[model samples]
Target: MLDISKLERRWLKYKIKKILPYTLLITTVTILGFTIPFVLSNRHSSKAMIPLKKDAIKVKAPNTENDEGAMVLEPSMHFIESMDTPSTPITNTPTSSTKPAPTPKHSIAPIASLPTPTPAIAQTQATKAPQPIVKGKLTSIKRDDTAFDIHEIEDRFKDTSNPNLGVYIAKYHYDHGNYSEAYNYALKTNSINNSIDDSWLIFAKALVKLGKEEQAKKTLQLYISNSNSQAAKNYLDTLDKGGSK
Candidate 1:
């Protein structure tokens, strides 16, 4: 019985040695199968999480020598940052309509026309002829056509019929340096026709030459106010400057 038990024990030991190696190998294979699939799935997931660029290209940095004289390439963060980002579409917002300001209206009144003067009033004004204010010997003399000679011309100037002829005679005498005769004739002409600018100018000039500067200046200023004559202004200037003729 003891010999049989020893044989059985030896056989059982041999079987355990052989089966243990096979059991360890099968357990390791099973564990590896499950771990390998899990690791592979994790790797795929991590690869999916990393962003991929369609236009990405490998860029080599400039070779730099290390202390061991070996070339090394360094990754550039600036180059990666400089890459273009995806553009977003721009949307335009709608605006509210604005109202225009109202224009102001102005009221305008029509101007009335002035009434025209009657013919009777005009005729009365025409009849009131200007008379000579200066009292001279020529103012009393009467014109005679029968005695209408050069000597009688000064006397004829007294007549109110034609004052322009008297003014011409006055200017002629003034041109010939006969200031006294010119003064008398100019006074007569002005008395007959005070509206004549030349008659007033010649009268003023003759008055200035005959040492009547104040009278000449007064007459010139009157004539200038009435006619606005340039010749009268010039003569007035000469009188102001103490100049004669």
Candidate 2:
């Protein structure tokens, strides 16, 4: 037999608004008092106070290096000369005409007709077929394209000491389906260094593409550990289902 009280309890607890009002926040000290997961001492023992050993706390203050100088931005004026200049002129001249006199005709040999000239040999031969333009993988990207090589981007991050370049490069590789390389490089580019949740997402996507199902599952689980992973967690559900869309 089903319990009657359980249904009533579930019904009464349906409104989250009702429960939210009861969850009042308490101080950290109060929280620490009751939340003793481990009881090291007997409850009946009177307080045994020992002098707290004062450890020398070394405070490492950030170097107060004054920024080099205030950026001196030059003010500029963009003067655009409008092309529609109004005043212009059009010129046309017509001159008067004069009449001339007539000339006499000759008889000669009318029976003799002019012979047609023989055609010349063809000047140009058929041009050979132009070679097809074939494209291969590029090794090193330049500043011009800002892309081409995965290593180039990695080197950029190395040169600039900017970890963000790794995120960009990893995303570029993952988006292009170079998942093996993406996953390989992602190991070096720590997810914590990039946008935490987003990097993990890209890593999961790369892992999925690389056919590392178990690793991808674990990666997604790590993502859901965050407080703000509602949407990511929903996506994780889809990934868990192996439902490729």
Candidate 2 lDDT, tens digit per residue, 108-195? 1010110111111000011112223334532221111224344555666566534344444555565445777667555555533533
Give the per-residue lDDT digits (tens) of candidate 1, residues 186-223: 78868866766667766877787798879888988988
Clashing residue pairs found in predicted model 1: none
Q: How accurate is candidate 1 locally (lDDT)?
A: 0.52
Q: Return the number of clashes found in candidate 2.
A: 0
lDDT of each: 0.52, 0.41
Number of backbone collisions per candidate? 0, 0
Stretches of candidate 2 exceeding 4 Å from the true structure:
1-150, 191-195
Q: Show the lowest summed lDDT stretch of 10 residues, model 2.
A: 88-97
Highest lDDT, which number? 1
